[model samples]
Target: MTVGPTSSTWTIQTRPPWFFRRVVTNAAAGGSVYLADLVTPRGMTVVVEPAKISFSTVAFNLIVEVDLSGVGRVDDVGIKSDYIGNHGYLSWVELNGTHVVRSPIVLFIASPRT
Candidate 1:
Protein backbone atom coordinates (compact mmCIF):
# COMPACT_ATOMS: atom_id res chain seq x y z
CA MET A 1 0.00 0.00 0.00
CA THR A 2 2.92 2.27 -0.66
CA VAL A 3 4.54 2.27 2.77
CA GLY A 4 6.56 5.33 3.72
CA PRO A 5 9.77 5.59 5.73
CA THR A 6 9.77 5.30 9.51
CA SER A 7 12.42 6.39 12.02
CA SER A 8 12.08 3.35 14.30
CA THR A 9 13.88 0.05 13.85
CA TRP A 10 11.63 -2.59 12.27
CA THR A 11 11.65 -6.13 13.56
CA ILE A 12 9.69 -8.72 11.59
CA GLN A 13 7.92 -11.38 13.56
CA THR A 14 9.02 -14.86 12.63
CA ARG A 15 6.73 -17.41 11.03
CA PRO A 16 7.13 -21.15 10.67
CA PRO A 17 9.52 -21.92 7.82
CA TRP A 18 6.89 -24.29 6.46
CA PHE A 19 4.55 -21.35 6.20
CA PHE A 20 6.94 -19.63 3.84
CA ARG A 21 7.47 -22.82 1.84
CA ARG A 22 3.77 -23.34 1.53
CA VAL A 23 3.24 -19.77 0.44
CA VAL A 24 6.00 -19.94 -2.12
CA THR A 25 4.95 -23.32 -3.47
CA ASN A 26 1.35 -22.23 -3.61
CA ALA A 27 2.38 -19.13 -5.49
CA ALA A 28 4.34 -21.23 -7.96
CA ALA A 29 1.43 -23.65 -8.23
CA GLY A 30 -0.81 -20.70 -9.04
CA GLY A 31 -2.44 -20.76 -5.64
CA SER A 32 -3.03 -17.68 -3.52
CA VAL A 33 -3.44 -16.87 0.16
CA TYR A 34 -3.17 -13.99 2.57
CA LEU A 35 0.36 -13.37 3.83
CA ALA A 36 -0.24 -12.13 7.34
CA ASP A 37 2.20 -10.51 9.73
CA LEU A 38 5.17 -10.43 7.35
CA VAL A 39 7.67 -7.63 7.88
CA THR A 40 10.82 -6.04 6.48
CA PRO A 41 12.90 -2.90 6.66
CA ARG A 42 11.99 0.18 4.69
CA GLY A 43 13.20 0.50 1.07
CA MET A 44 13.51 -3.28 0.81
CA THR A 45 11.30 -6.07 -0.51
CA VAL A 46 11.33 -9.70 0.67
CA VAL A 47 10.45 -12.45 -1.76
CA VAL A 48 9.74 -16.10 -0.95
CA GLU A 49 9.63 -19.19 -3.17
CA PRO A 50 8.82 -22.89 -2.69
CA ALA A 51 11.83 -24.31 -4.47
CA LYS A 52 14.07 -22.07 -2.47
CA ILE A 53 12.56 -22.97 0.88
CA SER A 54 15.46 -23.35 3.28
CA PHE A 55 16.76 -26.81 4.16
CA SER A 56 15.83 -25.94 7.71
CA THR A 57 12.24 -25.43 6.66
CA VAL A 58 11.04 -28.19 8.96
CA ALA A 59 13.66 -27.50 11.60
CA PHE A 60 14.39 -23.81 12.07
CA ASN A 61 12.61 -20.74 10.77
CA LEU A 62 14.60 -18.88 8.14
CA ILE A 63 15.38 -15.33 9.09
CA VAL A 64 17.28 -13.10 6.73
CA GLU A 65 18.24 -9.50 7.32
CA VAL A 66 18.40 -6.71 4.78
CA ASP A 67 20.65 -3.70 5.15
CA LEU A 68 18.49 -0.60 5.34
CA SER A 69 21.31 1.66 4.25
CA GLY A 70 20.24 4.06 7.03
CA VAL A 71 16.80 4.48 5.48
CA GLY A 72 13.65 3.85 7.45
CA ARG A 73 12.64 0.20 7.73
CA VAL A 74 9.59 -1.73 6.57
CA ASP A 75 7.77 -4.11 8.86
CA ASP A 76 4.44 -5.98 9.39
CA VAL A 77 4.65 -6.91 5.74
CA GLY A 78 2.21 -9.19 3.96
CA ILE A 79 0.56 -10.01 0.64
CA LYS A 80 -3.17 -10.27 0.22
CA SER A 81 -4.69 -13.24 -1.57
CA ASP A 82 -5.67 -10.94 -4.39
CA TYR A 83 -2.07 -9.82 -4.77
CA ILE A 84 -0.30 -12.06 -7.26
CA GLY A 85 1.59 -11.05 -10.37
CA ASN A 86 5.09 -10.57 -11.73
CA HIS A 87 6.88 -12.38 -8.93
CA GLY A 88 10.16 -11.91 -10.70
CA TYR A 89 11.57 -10.52 -7.49
CA LEU A 90 10.94 -13.84 -5.79
CA SER A 91 12.79 -15.62 -8.57
CA TRP A 92 15.67 -13.24 -8.20
CA VAL A 93 15.83 -13.85 -4.45
CA GLU A 94 15.72 -17.60 -5.02
CA LEU A 95 18.64 -17.40 -7.38
CA ASN A 96 20.64 -15.10 -5.11
CA GLY A 97 21.11 -15.02 -1.37
CA THR A 98 19.38 -12.35 0.69
CA HIS A 99 22.80 -10.74 1.27
CA VAL A 100 23.08 -10.00 -2.43
CA VAL A 101 19.46 -8.94 -2.65
CA ARG A 102 18.60 -5.50 -1.34
CA SER A 103 14.86 -5.63 -0.75
CA PRO A 104 13.46 -7.52 2.28
CA ILE A 105 9.75 -7.15 1.83
CA VAL A 106 7.48 -9.75 0.27
CA LEU A 107 4.33 -9.05 -1.73
CA PHE A 108 2.09 -10.48 -4.38
CA ILE A 109 1.36 -7.64 -6.79
CA ALA A 110 -1.49 -9.13 -8.85
CA SER A 111 -4.04 -11.92 -8.74
CA PRO A 112 -6.76 -13.36 -10.97
CA ARG A 113 -10.06 -11.64 -10.54
CA THR A 114 -12.75 -13.72 -8.93
Candidate 2:
Protein backbone atom coordinates (compact mmCIF):
# COMPACT_ATOMS: atom_id res chain seq x y z
CA MET A 1 0.00 0.00 0.00
CA THR A 2 1.43 3.37 -1.00
CA VAL A 3 0.88 6.48 1.07
CA GLY A 4 -0.17 9.84 -0.25
CA PRO A 5 -1.05 13.35 0.92
CA THR A 6 -2.46 13.77 4.49
CA SER A 7 -1.96 10.09 5.39
CA SER A 8 -5.66 9.37 4.88
CA THR A 9 -5.40 9.80 1.15
CA TRP A 10 -3.44 6.74 0.07
CA THR A 11 -2.69 4.76 -3.08
CA ILE A 12 -2.90 1.16 -1.96
CA GLN A 13 -1.94 -1.61 -4.35
CA THR A 14 -2.40 -5.32 -3.65
CA ARG A 15 -1.00 -8.20 -5.68
CA PRO A 16 -3.59 -9.99 -7.78
CA PRO A 17 -4.89 -13.12 -6.06
CA TRP A 18 -3.14 -16.37 -7.06
CA PHE A 19 -6.25 -18.49 -7.57
CA PHE A 20 -9.40 -17.61 -9.52
CA ARG A 21 -12.38 -17.04 -7.25
CA ARG A 22 -15.99 -15.83 -7.53
CA VAL A 23 -17.67 -13.24 -5.30
CA VAL A 24 -21.39 -12.52 -5.20
CA THR A 25 -24.44 -11.74 -3.14
CA ASN A 26 -26.96 -14.12 -1.57
CA ALA A 27 -29.40 -16.24 -3.62
CA ALA A 28 -32.43 -15.07 -1.67
CA ALA A 29 -31.96 -11.52 -2.91
CA GLY A 30 -35.21 -9.84 -4.01
CA GLY A 31 -38.22 -7.89 -2.75
CA SER A 32 -37.15 -4.35 -1.91
CA VAL A 33 -33.77 -4.96 -3.57
CA TYR A 34 -33.23 -2.35 -6.22
CA LEU A 35 -30.39 -2.65 -8.71
CA ALA A 36 -30.79 1.09 -9.35
CA ASP A 37 -29.72 1.77 -5.79
CA LEU A 38 -26.38 0.26 -6.71
CA VAL A 39 -23.96 3.11 -7.13
CA THR A 40 -20.46 2.82 -8.54
CA PRO A 41 -18.68 2.93 -5.20
CA ARG A 42 -15.49 4.78 -4.46
CA GLY A 43 -12.18 3.93 -2.74
CA MET A 44 -12.50 0.10 -3.26
CA THR A 45 -13.57 -2.45 -5.87
CA VAL A 46 -16.56 -4.74 -6.31
CA VAL A 47 -15.01 -8.01 -7.32
CA VAL A 48 -13.95 -11.53 -6.34
CA GLU A 49 -10.29 -12.10 -7.22
CA PRO A 50 -7.46 -11.35 -9.66
CA ALA A 51 -8.61 -7.73 -9.71
CA LYS A 52 -7.11 -4.45 -8.52
CA ILE A 53 -9.23 -2.41 -6.06
CA SER A 54 -9.00 0.87 -4.16
CA PHE A 55 -11.08 2.85 -1.64
CA SER A 56 -11.20 5.57 1.08
CA THR A 57 -14.07 6.22 3.52
CA VAL A 58 -15.28 9.52 4.99
CA ALA A 59 -16.17 9.48 8.67
CA PHE A 60 -18.56 12.42 8.62
CA ASN A 61 -21.35 11.77 6.05
CA LEU A 62 -20.66 8.01 5.82
CA ILE A 63 -20.50 8.08 2.06
CA VAL A 64 -18.56 5.60 -0.13
CA GLU A 65 -17.49 5.85 -3.76
CA VAL A 66 -16.29 2.81 -5.77
CA ASP A 67 -14.66 2.23 -9.14
CA LEU A 68 -14.35 -1.30 -10.69
CA SER A 69 -13.60 -0.63 -14.31
CA GLY A 70 -12.58 -3.47 -16.70
CA VAL A 71 -13.76 -5.94 -14.09
CA GLY A 72 -17.38 -5.27 -15.06
CA ARG A 73 -20.50 -6.35 -13.21
CA VAL A 74 -22.31 -9.70 -13.61
CA ASP A 75 -25.88 -10.11 -12.40
CA ASP A 76 -26.67 -13.16 -10.22
CA VAL A 77 -22.96 -13.89 -9.86
CA GLY A 78 -22.39 -16.95 -7.68
CA ILE A 79 -19.24 -15.96 -5.81
CA LYS A 80 -17.88 -14.45 -2.59
CA SER A 81 -15.25 -11.94 -1.52
CA ASP A 82 -13.86 -10.30 1.62
CA TYR A 83 -13.60 -6.93 -0.13
CA ILE A 84 -16.42 -5.57 2.01
CA GLY A 85 -13.73 -3.31 3.60
CA ASN A 86 -16.46 -1.30 5.36
CA HIS A 87 -18.05 -0.37 2.01
CA GLY A 88 -21.78 -0.72 1.31
CA TYR A 89 -21.55 -1.42 -2.42
CA LEU A 90 -21.37 -5.16 -1.94
CA SER A 91 -24.16 -4.98 0.58
CA TRP A 92 -26.34 -3.10 -1.92
CA VAL A 93 -26.29 -6.09 -4.28
CA GLU A 94 -28.68 -7.95 -2.05
CA LEU A 95 -31.53 -6.36 -0.17
CA ASN A 96 -31.66 -9.21 2.37
CA GLY A 97 -28.10 -8.26 3.38
CA THR A 98 -24.71 -10.14 3.53
CA HIS A 99 -23.07 -12.17 0.75
CA VAL A 100 -22.10 -15.83 0.43
CA VAL A 101 -18.70 -17.40 -0.34
CA ARG A 102 -18.50 -20.54 -2.48
CA SER A 103 -16.36 -22.38 -5.04
CA PRO A 104 -16.94 -21.16 -8.57
CA ILE A 105 -17.36 -24.68 -9.88
CA VAL A 106 -17.18 -28.32 -8.84
CA LEU A 107 -16.61 -31.47 -10.91
CA PHE A 108 -18.26 -34.72 -9.87
CA ILE A 109 -16.98 -38.07 -11.13
CA ALA A 110 -19.53 -40.78 -11.72
CA SER A 111 -20.17 -43.81 -13.88
CA PRO A 112 -21.64 -42.94 -17.26
CA ARG A 113 -25.34 -43.62 -17.52
CA THR A 114 -25.91 -46.89 -19.44
Candidate 3:
Protein backbone atom coordinates (compact mmCIF):
# COMPACT_ATOMS: atom_id res chain seq x y z
CA MET A 1 0.00 0.00 0.00
CA THR A 2 1.23 3.51 -0.86
CA VAL A 3 1.64 5.17 2.50
CA GLY A 4 2.86 8.42 3.98
CA PRO A 5 2.97 9.17 7.68
CA THR A 6 -0.73 9.01 8.62
CA SER A 7 0.23 10.72 11.85
CA SER A 8 3.28 11.58 13.88
CA THR A 9 3.70 7.86 14.39
CA TRP A 10 4.93 5.63 11.58
CA THR A 11 2.56 2.74 11.76
CA ILE A 12 0.82 1.19 8.76
CA GLN A 13 -1.75 -1.58 8.48
CA THR A 14 -2.85 -3.94 5.75
CA ARG A 15 -5.40 -6.67 5.09
CA PRO A 16 -5.21 -10.09 6.80
CA PRO A 17 -3.50 -13.36 5.96
CA TRP A 18 -0.26 -11.52 6.42
CA PHE A 19 2.15 -13.90 4.79
CA PHE A 20 4.11 -11.50 2.67
CA ARG A 21 7.46 -9.80 2.35
CA ARG A 22 7.36 -6.09 3.11
CA VAL A 23 9.39 -3.55 1.22
CA VAL A 24 9.18 0.11 2.10
CA THR A 25 11.36 1.78 -0.42
CA ASN A 26 12.35 5.43 -0.82
CA ALA A 27 12.48 5.72 2.90
CA ALA A 28 13.93 9.19 2.96
CA ALA A 29 14.54 11.44 5.97
CA GLY A 30 14.52 8.76 8.64
CA GLY A 31 11.63 6.51 7.74
CA SER A 32 9.95 4.04 10.10
CA VAL A 33 10.80 0.37 10.73
CA TYR A 34 9.73 -1.92 13.52
CA LEU A 35 7.91 -5.12 14.48
CA ALA A 36 5.09 -6.30 12.26
CA ASP A 37 1.70 -6.78 13.90
CA LEU A 38 -1.28 -8.74 12.72
CA VAL A 39 -4.89 -7.54 12.92
CA THR A 40 -6.71 -10.70 13.93
CA PRO A 41 -9.96 -11.40 12.13
CA ARG A 42 -13.22 -11.99 13.92
CA GLY A 43 -13.66 -15.44 15.50
CA MET A 44 -9.94 -16.02 15.15
CA THR A 45 -7.16 -15.80 17.70
CA VAL A 46 -3.43 -15.47 17.56
CA VAL A 47 -1.93 -18.89 17.16
CA VAL A 48 1.66 -18.42 15.98
CA GLU A 49 2.20 -15.36 18.14
CA PRO A 50 3.66 -12.18 16.74
CA ALA A 51 7.43 -11.93 16.38
CA LYS A 52 9.54 -8.90 17.15
CA ILE A 53 11.12 -7.17 14.18
CA SER A 54 14.65 -5.82 13.98
CA PHE A 55 15.60 -3.77 10.94
CA SER A 56 18.59 -1.60 10.11
CA THR A 57 18.13 1.45 7.84
CA VAL A 58 21.80 1.76 7.05
CA ALA A 59 21.40 0.08 3.64
CA PHE A 60 17.75 -1.04 3.50
CA ASN A 61 18.56 -4.60 2.43
CA LEU A 62 18.21 -5.93 5.95
CA ILE A 63 15.75 -8.81 6.14
CA VAL A 64 13.25 -8.85 8.98
CA GLU A 65 11.57 -11.97 10.31
CA VAL A 66 8.02 -11.56 11.63
CA ASP A 67 5.69 -14.27 12.96
CA LEU A 68 1.90 -14.28 12.75
CA SER A 69 -0.38 -16.60 14.71
CA GLY A 70 -4.12 -16.84 14.17
CA VAL A 71 -6.92 -18.84 12.64
CA GLY A 72 -10.62 -18.89 11.53
CA ARG A 73 -10.70 -15.19 10.72
CA VAL A 74 -8.56 -12.77 8.77
CA ASP A 75 -7.74 -9.26 9.91
CA ASP A 76 -5.60 -6.38 8.96
CA VAL A 77 -1.98 -6.40 10.09
CA GLY A 78 -0.35 -3.39 11.64
CA ILE A 79 3.32 -2.70 11.12
CA LYS A 80 5.52 -0.74 13.48
CA SER A 81 8.74 1.06 12.75
CA ASP A 82 11.52 2.42 14.96
CA TYR A 83 12.23 5.39 12.77
CA ILE A 84 9.38 7.87 12.84
CA GLY A 85 8.89 11.43 11.56
CA ASN A 86 9.86 10.19 8.16
CA HIS A 87 9.16 12.32 5.12
CA GLY A 88 9.14 9.25 2.91
CA TYR A 89 6.10 7.12 2.13
CA LEU A 90 5.48 3.37 2.03
CA SER A 91 5.87 1.37 -1.15
CA TRP A 92 5.09 -2.33 -1.10
CA VAL A 93 4.18 -5.32 1.11
CA GLU A 94 4.62 -8.81 -0.23
CA LEU A 95 3.31 -11.96 1.47
CA ASN A 96 5.55 -14.93 2.20
CA GLY A 97 3.59 -17.98 1.14
CA THR A 98 6.00 -20.43 2.70
CA HIS A 99 4.35 -20.21 6.11
CA VAL A 100 0.73 -19.39 5.26
CA VAL A 101 -0.94 -22.35 6.85
CA ARG A 102 -3.70 -22.99 9.34
CA SER A 103 -2.59 -22.78 12.92
CA PRO A 104 -2.00 -26.07 14.69
CA ILE A 105 -3.65 -24.68 17.77
CA VAL A 106 -6.92 -23.68 16.11
CA LEU A 107 -9.10 -25.78 13.91
CA PHE A 108 -11.28 -23.66 11.59
CA ILE A 109 -14.22 -24.53 9.37
CA ALA A 110 -15.50 -22.23 6.67
CA SER A 111 -19.24 -21.85 6.77
CA PRO A 112 -21.34 -20.56 3.93
CA ARG A 113 -23.74 -17.70 4.34
CA THR A 114 -27.43 -18.37 3.83
Best by TM-score: 3
TM-score attained by model 1:
0.18
Worst 10 residues of 3 by lDDT: 97-106
* TM-score for candidate 3, residues paired by index: 0.27
lDDT of 1 by residue, 1-114 (tens): 111231223333232221222212222222222222334433344433322333323223333332222112122234345533221132223232222222234322333467
Residue-level lDDT tens digits of model 3 in 25-95 = 32333333443334443333432222433233433433332233333322221223332121212212224
| Model 1 misplacement above 4 A | 1-53, 56-60, 70-114
Measured by lDDT, the strongest candidate is 3
The order of the candidates by TM-score, greatest first, is 3, 1, 2
TM-scores for the candidates: 0.18, 0.17, 0.27
RMSD of 2: 18.2
Report how far residue 47 has shifted in candidate 1, in Å: 13
Q: After superposition, how far is residue 10 of candidate 1 from its true place, in Å?
A: 6.2
Ranking by lDDT: 3, 1, 2
How many times do residue backbones clash in model 2? 14
lDDT of model 1 at position 46: 48
C-alpha displacement of 29 in model 2, angstroms?
Answer: 13
